[model samples]
Target chain A: MAIVAQTSRFSKIAWPVVAWIVGLIFFFPIFYMVMTSFKTDADAVNPEFLFSFTPTLENYANMTDNYDYWRFATNSIITSVFATLFALVVGVPCAYSMAFSPTRSTKDILMWMLSTKMLPAAAVLYPMTFLTKNVLGVFDTHFLVIVVLCLINLPIVVWMLFTYFKDIPKDIIEAGQMDGLNTWGEIKEILIPLAWGGIVSTALLTFIFCWNEAYWTVRLTTIDAATLSKLIEGNRAPEGLFFGRLSAVSTAAVGPIIVLGWFCQKQLVQGLTFGAVK
Target chain B: MANRTIPRILQTPAVILLLIWMLVPLSLTLFYSFIRYVLNSTVRPEWMTPSFSNWRGFGNYEFVLNSKDFWFAVKNSIFIVTSILTLTVVLGVLIAVLINRSFPGRGIVRVLLISPFFVMPAVNAVLWINMLLDPVLGLQGIAVNNINTLIGGLQDAPIVGWFFNMWPVFEPISFRATQTSSIAVIMMVTWQWTPFAVLIFMTSLQSEDQQQKEAAILDGASRWSQFRFLTLPHLGRPMAIVVMIQAIFHLSLYAEIEIVSRGNGNKNLPYLIGEFANNNIGAASATGIFAVILANIVAIFLLRMVGKTLME
Candidate 1:
């Protein structure tokens, strides 16, 4: 008993120290990014000022002049927000039907939706470009960006919403139906009310995904509909020269989404896994 | 079922939207793959436009297969994806078990741990390549410089002078170099995803049966035995889910690879496709078809595993 207790005590002390180390190691890059953001570009590269620098906000202040940060940010915000809303508008009804009234093909359909997500975006890049540029003539427009973002994310959005909607009791929706509520009334009044948490979390996760999405968002649009991704890519500042302003802008780009992500950490597991883990 | 008609009607919009979304670009890709398509061709100007007359059956497929870069990209893609998957799952399980028990500041620790996943891939690659792993101007350089400085200082000391003199100067690794850029991508991706693994495994851990665990304890089972017998089995489903979902996502990884090496020498399948799409639409289309086949193979396997549980 004494031996067991001794080992247990040792483990209790050791585990948290290990946990702290792991956490810090994982977070060090982001921490370093934020830290470097305060230094001048010269100081950012200077070895002596690596740890203890006289911090400044000059980079952040010049962000507008430097990167045209707001335009790209607004574009990201506009596209991501509208895209998330559109995905939800499309996803909810689809998911609700599949969850409540699953057909023999419903599972196959859901799996098929998921498989579309695995289609390498680059594989279809030329086709998308050719279509949008030549046939549709909507290249580099905000509408194109919004539609592309919404479509790219639609699969995950539907999958996540399906998983969430599955957890709701069928009796609740049925009871609403029993009360002579129309389908719209049943969805708006009962289903949405009950699945509000799921919908909100799905939206939050979808928004994070949309904001962080890089491949299509970067490739599909140029100047007219360029989001923050294009800004970061265009101004990547190779060779670590502009660590100060680069860090500032990178932080600016990912900061809000990361904070928003903090709120939806739990839901992230469900969203990422399509609720398989949960 | 009056309610059923309305529900099905409501679903029509989403279904139709996704159907078009999936079919249009894909059919175009299919069409282009079979045709001798090129964005620009001076000798044969008509070949520039996609038409049935331009069709060259299996020619593009042969072009991609014979290309050295395509094979290299396929191998590198598999290498990077497999390495990340293995690292994440192993680390994820260990860390999940380690932090599964109640501990002080566990919530805060989890929050801190999961921070990387939220970071944009572009920012993640930039942060790692510049700040953390830069050979000369980044933390790696600073740390190496500090160590060398410390060694130099010690070399002047009387007793430790001989020992310090014996030590060779350390060199910081340049991750941007050809062979190591994949390592950088793997490192950044692993860091970002281990938390995801931990999150899933931990969730599954919470559902682990305490009574069964206690029973094993009373039966004089060792901790390793108990974990092996009970906990590992419990984690099987989550592990599969993590691997399957990650396989799907990482198989198509692009931005990280693009941002890290700029498709220099470390090109994956998707990157290769992008490279060919510059002018050789035929080769790009064939590569796209191959990518689709690869994805379908994995998708069929994964969907089969989770299919039953998903429906129920």
Candidate 2:
């Protein structure tokens, strides 16, 4: 009794302080970036005004005039939305077949799909460029970004949906089939509703990945289809020239996704690590 | 149940898409690696076009193998990935344990910790390099310069003057330099990913057998011993998952390296491939093949570790 009481007392005082300190330390960089975004380029470089400055919305207000922020933001939305939708459309049927109808080769096919994710994007850079520009003539277009994003994320989407579908008992889906439902009807009426939470989380997670994707988005698109990743990449000032404007643009770029991430924090762990941890 | 047509039809779009996505570019890469191909050739214009007649089988591979930059990039890639994995796992375990128990601000702590993981890679690089790591204007510069000035002032204090004088002036490292840029990349990536590790481990920790832990406690297990025997084992699966997922992500890490170093002094395999792709199509393709091989070496271990569980 005494030992348990002593331990509880010790934990009560120690844990909260440690938790607060850790949280603040982790958040300091983002806080600093937001803080720096209010300072002029000159004040941003000066140590005297590090914490206190004449806070300005000039950077945020002038973002469109200075950097043309909306074009990239629109491109990001168009590509990420369509790409995620495409992945789900393709992934749903495949996951449905594998989940309901198990075979000896199902595991092998799943593993093979995952193996595609490991293929380095750099390995296919020149070939993709050649095909897009020289052959297909779709270079720097929203269609190309959408296609690339869909292909890259399809494996994870399939894996996620498979895991979600596997959790649903075979009886419910089997019963739906016996109730005079066709394949598409079974998916729409039975599977989709049962797995609504999983599907929503999967879509949200896929959107986040598509938005944060830097490599293909930056390399494949120059201006027309350039996403926020490209915007931030192109506007990376050498040193301290425009820290305020830079931070504002960056804040604008990642702000929505981070907020979206907060709402789906629970799903994030399961989605990202693919439930291997949980 | 043995109906093949419906299942095959269902999976066709996915399989065909991935097949083309994988095969088309890779086969082209193979062809380019064999032939003498260049985007430009002033003297021998024939070298500009990719053709079988211009076959230089294995020559590009040999050239890549012989190049010093290729080896450096390989070494640096391993160094950065290994370092980030090690740091994330270690720090992750500690933080996960720290926040595993109920606390007043646990929710807020989690939000703060996980924020870095969602920051776009490009923004992460820009924020770290320009705002935090810059020598003159970033936090490092501001902090170091302040410390130096304070020491300079204390140097005139009669008896303490001698002591302060003996201390040499401090210098802030320019992380953008050749040798240090890799370190910078490693630091920023570790910051972004450690939260991912912590989240996974924490989830796994929540599922740990509390009754078993209580039994150990009643059996007089010391704190260190309890951690070693109970907690560590519980975290094994999560650790493996963390390592494999991080391996896949960091193996092709590019935007951070590009934005931070631009291959000035620090180049990873992906960055090297990018550089080669700029003009030398043959060399880039060969290097791409090498990168593919390196990823496969890591992927084999990853598959063995997680593939079974994923199937289940």
Candidate 3:
């Protein structure tokens, strides 16, 4: 009994310490980046001033002059917001109908949508470039970025909305129908109010995805519609020369999305796994 | 009749959009793969445009298959995906279990852990390669130098001098090299994604049956046995979900590979495709088709698992 008691007591202190250590280790790089942002370029790479450097806002202040940070940031905001709105607009109705009155083929259709997500974007890279640049002449436009982002994220949005909608009892929708509400009225009045939480989270997750999207946003845009991802990729080979300013810009690019991510960590599992795990 | 028709109408726009999104570009790729095409070929200017007149049948596929880089990219892709999947799952399970219990600052711990998942892949790559892994100015270099300095000091001591003298000087690794670039990609991606796996596993853990665990304790089952039998089985479904979802995402890993080494020593199928697309449209299209085929094989199994859970 004493042996068991001693071991249990030892574990009680050890567990939390271990957990905190692991968490700090994982977070150290971001913490270091943020810390480095306050140093000058010289101090950033200097070994002597590794941790004791005088902090300055020069990196953040000179960001615009150095990188044209605002232009790219504005582009990121415009595309991600519109894409999220568009995906929800298309996704909600599809998920609503499928949830309320799923037919035999509903399952297959849902699976097919997900399968489309699995199609490697690299394979279609040339075709998309050719079509947009040559045929449609819409390359590097905000509209093109929005449409591509929306299309890529539409499947996840629908799947998330479907799972959320499935949780609401069908009796509510049926009652709305019996009240002489048409499909549109049922969705607008009843379903929307009930699944409001789910919709917001889905939109939030989709927005985060659009913001962090690196491939299409980077590949498709050159200057006009390029997001923060493009800006960072363009300056990728800094070779430690501009670590301070680079960290500042990179921090700016991902800071808001990381904060936003905290709120929807719960929804992320459902969003990414299609609610299969839960 | 009206009921089914309205539901179908609601679904039509989404279905049709996805269909067009999937088919048009892909069909173009398929068409291009069968033809002789190049963006710039002064010797064969006729081959520059995509047309049936430049039909090459299976020749492009043959070319991609015969290329040495194509095989290396395929092998490297498999190696990277599997390494990341293995590391994330192992580390994820341990961390999830570690924090699963109530502890001081648990909420803060979780937020910190998950922050990496939200970092843009480009930022993740740059931060790791230049700021953390650079052999000269990175933290790795600084830390290694400090340790070697410490060892040098210890070598002047009396009894510990012999031991310190035997210690080798620590040298920082350059992750930008061809051999280590893929490893860098795997490291950064694993750091970014372990949080995702941890979050899912922790959620699944919350739903585990406490009654079974208590009963196992009453039967004198050790901690390992209880976890192995009860918790491990409970985690099986979540584990599968993690593996499949990650496999799909990491198989097409691009920004990380590009930013890490610029495909210097590390090139995956997507990188290889991007390279080919620079000039050889036919070979690029053929490689793209192969990438699609690879993704589909993984997708089919994932879809089957997801379908089983659907409509339930």
Candidate 4:
């Protein structure tokens, strides 16, 4: 009894300290970025200013002159929002059908939809460039970016909503059926209210994915629809000369998305794992 | 009959959209892989455009197969993926188990931990390369210089002077070099993805059978044994899911590789393809096809597992 009590006493003090230390270590890079953003370019690399330096907002102030931060940011916001909306519009109905009234091939269709995601974007870049640039004539436009984002994210949207909707009792939907309600009415009233949290998480997560979607966003656009990802990658501190402004721009690009990510961290598992883990 | 038709009609839009999205470009890649094509050709300019008459049967594939970069890319891809898998899983399991129990500031801990996973890969690569890993100006450089200075000061002390004099000056490693660039990528990517693995494993840990764990404890199983025998087995499926998901995602890791070293010596399959796409359209398409085959092999196992459990 004494030994057990002593071990418990030891663990009570040790565990939280260890956990706090681990958390801080993981968060240090973000802290460093935010801290570096407050310095001038000269102070950014100076070892003497590592801990003690006059903090300045000059980096944030000169963001427009330096990188045209707002143009790319607005593009990112426009594309990500519209893409999320479009995906939800298409995904909700498909997932609803699969969940409430799954046929024999519903499972196969879901699997096949997921397989499309595994088709690498790099493999198809040339064809997409050729089609969009020459044939479609919509290259580097917001509409093209929105459509591409929506298509890539549709499968995960359907899969996440299906998992959420699967948990609702089938009898509830059938109860609406016995009441003579039409299909749209049943979904609007019975299905959606029960799965509202699921729907919101799916949207939020999708928006996050669209925001952080560096690959397609960077490759597809040139100037008009170039996102914050493109802006940051295009100006990667040539010779480490502009670390201060670069950090400011990067922090601005990802800060909102990171905070947004915190709210949907719980749903990331179902979304990324194809609802398989839970 | 009406209900069935409605569901089918509703699903048709999504299905058709995905079908077009998947088929159009892939077929183009497949077609181009067989033909002779280049974006710019000063000599034999007729071959510049993609056409059936210029089909070089398996010539592109042969060139890709024999190139030293292709083989290096294949080996480097395997190495990066395998190293990340090992690191994320091990670190993920440890961190997941550590925080599984209720503790102070758990919410804050989780919030801090998950922040890294959301950073844009472009930002991640740039941040690591410039602010964190640069030899002369990064935090790494500053820390090394500080340590050497401190050791130099110690070398002046009376008793520890001899001990400090024996210690060599610390030299910071430049991560943009050929040999160590891949290690830099592995570090940054592991930093980004370890949180993802933790999230999955933590979710799986919540569903772990508490009663089974208690029984093992009552049977006098030590902590290590209990975790090894019970927790590890219970997490098998989630671990597999994490591994496969990461495999699919990291196989196409381009932004990091592009920003960090520009494939200085750390070229993976995707980077290799990007390099080829500069002028050699045929070779790039063929390599893209090879990447597709590699991704599909992993995707098949994952889809099978997911399909089985999905219906259940």
Highest-scoring model, lDDT: 3
Clashing residue pairs in all predictions, respectively, total 0, 0, 1, 0
Candidate 2 lDDT over residue span A188-249, tens digit each: 99999999999998999999999999999999998899999999999765568888889888
RMSD of each: 1.9, 1.6, 1.6, 1.6
TM-score winner between 1 and 3, please give it: 3
lDDT of 2: 0.89
Candidate 1 per-residue C-alpha lDDT over B117-179 given as tens digits, one digit per residue, 9 for 90 to 100: 999888888888888889899888989999999999999999879999999999999898778
Instruction: lDDT for model 1, please.
Output: 0.87
Off by over 4 Å in 2: A1-3, A6-11, B157-162
List the DockQ of the predictions in order: 0.66, 0.73, 0.71, 0.69
Model 4 residue A29 CA deviation (Å) reads 0.3
Of the true interface contacts, the fraction found in model 3 is: 0.81
Q: Write the per-residue lDDT of candidate 2 for residues B1-312, one digit (tens) a residue.
A: 557678778988998999999999999998999988889889889989889999998999999999999999999999999999999999999999999887777888899989988999999999998899999989999999999999999999887899999998999888888889889899999989998999899999999998888888888887789889999999998898899889889989999999988747689999999999988999999999999998998888877766767766
Query: What tens digits encode model 3's per-residue C-alpha lDDT throughout A1-278?
Result: 42243348779899999999999999999999999999999999999999998999999999999999999999999999999999999999999989988998999899999999999999999999999999999999999999999999999999999999999998899988889999889999999999999999999999999999999999999999999999999999998899999999999999999999999999999999998987
Error in Å for residue A101 of model 2 = 1.4
lDDT of 1 by residue, A111-137 (tens): 888777778787788999988988999
Model 3 scores a TM of 0.98
Q: lDDT tens string, model 4, A139-208?
A: 9999999999999999999999999999998899889989988888988989889999999999999999
